[model samples]
Target chain A: LQALENIQLDLEAVNIKAGKAFLRLKRKFIQMRRPFLERRDLIIRHIPGFWVKAFLNHPKISILINRRDEDIFRYLTNLQVQDLRHISMGYKMKLYFQTNPYFTNMVIVKEFQRNRSGRLVSHSTPIRWHRGQEPQARRHRNQDTNHSFFIWFSNHSLPEADRIAEIIKNDLWVNPLRYYMMGEGVVRSWASERQTLERPSCFRFWIQ
Target chain B: LQALENIQLDLEAVNIKAGKAFLRLKRKFIQMRRPFLERRDLIIRHIPGFWVKAFLNHPKISILINRRDEDIFRYLTNLQVQDLRHISMGYKMKLYFQTNPYFTNMVIVKEFQRNRSGRLVSHSTPIRWHRGQEPQARRHRNQDTNHSFFIWFSNHSLPEADRIAEIIKNDLWVNPLRYYMMGEGVVRSWASERQTLERPSCFRFWIQ
Candidate 1:
C-alpha cells in the first residue's frame, strides 16, 4: 500500500510539472502573437515635449523611381519622403488620431520631396497634429488650395496601418468628423483610404 | 465556526486569482523587454512552408545617391542598390549561420541588381543555405576572388542593436572561421566587421 501511495505522489508531481509547462507554452504563443512595440529614429510621442522638434531622429526619406504603379505604393514601413514642405511650405493637411490619442505616423507621398540622393529634405510638420481631434488643411497657406493630406493611424501593432489602428481603437476615440474606415486588415484599410485620397498626377502624390 | 470556515475558503479562492494576476503582470513586463518581429515581403520561414509566401505584400526598394558617406549606409532596411551584382557577380563570398543554421536574409548591395526605378533583380540564391549548417561561398561563382558579402540581423525592437545582439548571443554560435564582433549593442559589433570588410567605393557597401 505504501509503494502504491508513493507512486501516486510521483504521478501527481509529474502532472503538476506538465501543467506548468503547458501554461508556459500557451503564454509563449500568446506573447508571440501580441503586437510588438515599434522603435523609429523619430517617435511622435502622445505626450508633447516643450520643443518644436517632437521627433527624436528626424529620418530622411527617399523616392523609388521606375517601378510598377502597384509596387510604388508598397513598402512604406521605413519609407522616406524628402522636402515635402515645397508642396505647400506652410500648408496644413487633414489627419486624425483614433486608436491612439495621437496621430503618430503617416506616409503622405505627395508632400514628401527628395534630392537626387533620394533623401527626404522636408520636415514633418507637428503643428497640424492634435490629440483626439481631426487634422485640417490650412486654407491660408493655400499654395495649391486643393491639397488635402489625409493620414490614418491603425492598431498599435507598431508596423502597418492595422496595428496602429488597433492602438487607436484600444483607446476608443470616435471623432465627430468626416472619416470612414473600409477594409479588414491594417495595410488594406489604410491603403483603401490612400487610394481614395489620391487624385490626378498634378502633384497627386506619386509623380511629385 | 461554520461561517469562519466559509470565509477562509473565499480567501483561498481570492489568493489563487491574485497569484495568476501577478504572474501575468510579470510576464507582461518581460514581454515588453523582448525583441519584436520584422514583417517583410518575404520571410524565409524557420519552419517549412505550407504557404508559398509568408508575408502578405512584397515591398519596393529604392536607391539613394550623393548622400554623406555615413548617411549612405544609414538605412539598410529599405535602402536599394541597383546593378550591385556587377561588384563581384559570379563572385565568392563567405557566410555562416549560428543560432539559425540558415543565414536566411542577405543584403547583397551590388549583386542584387535592380532596374532604373529600383527593384531587386537577382532572387537571393538559396543554394548556399542548409537547415542546420554554416554557409559556404560558391568558388565557381567567385568571378572576383577578393569579394566577400557579410550581413547582420537585429531583433525588431524599433530601435537599438543590443537587443538583436542579445538574441544572437542567446543562442551563441561560435564558429571556427575568422569572425569578430565588437559593440555595446547590435549596430556597432557588426558595423566594425563591415568597416573591415569594406574594400573601396567600387560598389563598396556604403556607396554605389
Candidate 2:
C-alpha cells in the first residue's frame, strides 16, 4: 500500500510540472499573435478614402507591390494610363503624400480626375522639375488652388511631412494620416522648421 | 426680418457641416490608431524574456553585437569568446544573431542571464562546422555538447543577410524575430533548413 501511494505521489508531481510547462508555452504563443493582429488592424484604418475599400474589395484588383522597391517609380509612371480609365468610372482619383524624406520624399506624380458632362477629365502634375530647393516659380505653380484634389509629396524634412500632412488632413481628405518615424540616419531637408506635433492624428484638413 | 432669417439658416447649415466633418475625422483617427497600437503592442509582447520583465530578468546584462565584418566561423568561435569575463557576472552568455536571407535582414547580438536549477535548459547545438560544403576537421574540436543555444547563419542563395535572419526565427527564439521572406531571385537549398522547437522560457550561457 505504501509503494502504491508513493507511485501516486510521483505521478501527481509529474502532472504538475507538465501543466506548468503547458501554461508557459500557451502564454508565449498568445504573446506572439498579438503583434500580427495589431499591424493588420492599423492598415485598414489608415487606408485612404472609399476608393481604397473599393479597390481592396474588388475581385479584379490585385496588390501590385508587396514590399518597397526602387522600381516603384517606373511601375507607377510606366503603367499604361489606360488601366486607370476604369478607376475614373466609379471613384474620384486623387493622391496624397506628406513631406517626409524617408516616407514619401517626392510627390513623383499627382493625377486628378473630374467628372465633367459624363466624361472623365484628367489632369496631372509631376514634381520632377523641382528637385533640390523649390524655386519661387515652382512653388507658385505647385500651390494647390483647386481644393478638390492634389498630391502631397511629403518629400521634405520631418517637420515638413508633419505640417503638409496635417494641413491636407484639415483641408481636403476624409481619411486619418499615418506619420512614419525614421528608424536611423536621416539626411536632406525638405520643409521649413516647425514644432513637432504631439499627436499624429490631429492633423486634419481645415480650410480657413 | 427676411434677411435675418436667411442668415440664421446659413449659420445652422454651417454648424451642421462642421459637426459632420468632426465626426468623420474622429472615426478615421480611431481607425488609423489601431495599427500603430498593434505594432507597439507586438513590440512589447514579443520583446523576449531576458531583455526585460518576466523570467530571468538580470540587472547587469550585455547587449548583442552586430558582427558584420566577421564570417560565421569567426562569429561563433572567436567573437563570442572574446572578453567573456566582461559579459556577465560569471554566467555563461548566449549570442543572438540577426540573420535572414529573405525580406528584412539585420545582424544583432543579445545577452541573457543564467538559471541552472530550471526544469528545461536550452542548448544551442553547434550545427554548422566548416561553413558550407568542404569539411575542415579542425572546426570539429570546438563542437558544443551542452547544446544550450542555436545560431542560424543566413543562406547565401537568399541574400546572405535576409536568409540568415529567417533561419534564426524558424529555429530559435520567438517574436521580434528579425527576418525577411524569400524574394524571386533568392532560393532555399535542402542543406539550409530551419532548426527550432517549441521550448519554454530558458537561459542562454556564453562559454569560451
Candidate 3:
C-alpha cells in the first residue's frame, strides 16, 4: 500500500506538468490565430448586421436577447474578444455600437481577470442609459423571464454570465459566418444541415 | 454587396488556415502528453481495482454496468487509449484482463478509424464466450433495461457507443485517480467535493 501511495504521488506530479504544458500550447495557439482574427474583423465590418445576425442564430445567446435587446443589437457595429496576456490570466470582450437611443457608451467592455488566488474577478463599463431608455432597468428585478441581453454585462455575480462569455469567445467568435448563414436561412440548423448546403466554389470552403 | 462578397471570400481563406493551424497544435499537444500518461499507467497498475473503481464512479459508465458486467470488470487489469497517428484520423482502446471464467481473450481491443470520405469506421475483437456464459446473449435482445456493458463491444451501429468511447478516452483516462477517489468515498461527488478534501502534504497534490 505504501508503494502504491508513492506511485500515486509520482503520477500527480506528472499530471500537473502535463496541465502546465497544455496551457502553454493553448496560449501559443491563441497568439498564432490573432492576425487572422483581426483580418476577419475588417471583412465582417463591411457585411451589414453580421454580428447581430450571428448572435441571433446562436442557441444560447439567441435565447438571451429579448425584443428590446434585438432592437439594440441592430446598432452593433463590431465585436472583439482578446485574451489578456494568456487565457489563464483572463479575457476581455468589447462590443462596439453606433449612436443609439439605448445607451451613450460607444464601446462597452467586459473584462475577466484571475486574481492571485485564482478566483475570477470581472469588471464591466456601466451602460450610461438615456433616461427612460434603460432596457434592463425596465424589466422587473424579480422577474424570471424576458430579461435583456445587456443584463449580462452588469450581472457578473451570476455564473451563467461566465458561461455566456465562454460561448462568445470560443464558439461565436471562432465561426460567426456559420451562425450568420444559419440566420440567413441558408441552413436549417447548425449540426444537421452542415453538409447539406450546396454552394459556389468560393463559398464551399466556409460551409464545412 | 459585391465588395462585401469579396471580403467574405478573403475571410474564409483566413478561417481555413486558422482551422488547420489549430488541428496541428492539438496534435502536438497530444504527443507531448503521451510520456506522462505512460508513467501514470505504470503507477495505477500497482493499485488494485483502480480501473474498476474509476469506472463505477463515472456517471455514464456506471449506469451502463449491470450486475454481471460489474463481475467481469473485477477481472479488468488495465485500460489504455491511444490516438492513431493524429486525433482526427481516429483512436484505439485496449482493455487487458486476467484469465477469467467468462471469456478466453486476455485483451479486448476496440478501434475507430476515419474512412477516406471521413465517415467513422469502428472494429472490435469478438468476445469468445464459453458456451451459455455469454452475458450479453442472455439479455433479451429487445429489452430496454439491465443490458450488460459488454454489449457495447458488439453494437457498433449505436451513436451512443461513440460518445461513450469519447468519455473513456478524454475523461476517464485523463485523471483516473479523481474518479477512483470518488469511488472510495473520499469525495461525495466529483465536482462539488473536489475542494473539500483535506490530505497530508504527500497526498495534497492529487486532491485538487
Give TM-scores for every candidate, taking all chains together and pairing residue i with residue i: 0.20, 0.18, 0.51
Q: Arrange candidates by TM-score, highest first: which order?
A: 3, 1, 2
User: Candidate 3 clash total?
Assistant: 0
Q: Whole-model Cα lDDT per candidate?
A: 0.25, 0.27, 0.66
Fnat of every candidate, listed in order: 0.00, 0.00, 0.05
Tell me the spans in candidate 2 whose CA falls farther than 4 Å from its real position. A1-124, A127-162, A170-208, B1-208
The predicted structure with the larger TM-score, 1 or 3, is 3
lDDT of 3 by residue, B94-184 (tens): 9999999889999999887644433457889999988877754666653533465788866677432255776676556655666777645
- In candidate 1 chain B, where is summed lDDT lowest over 10 consecutive residues? B53-62
Between prediction 1 and prediction 2, which has the larger DockQ?
2
Candidates' interface RMSDs, in order?
27.1, 24.5, 9.6
Question: lDDT tens string, model 3, A143-207?
Answer: 53355578877777743225677668656765577677775543546433753453222221121
True contacts kept of 2: 0.00
Question: What docking grade applies to model 1?
Answer: incorrect
By lDDT: ranked, best first:
3, 2, 1
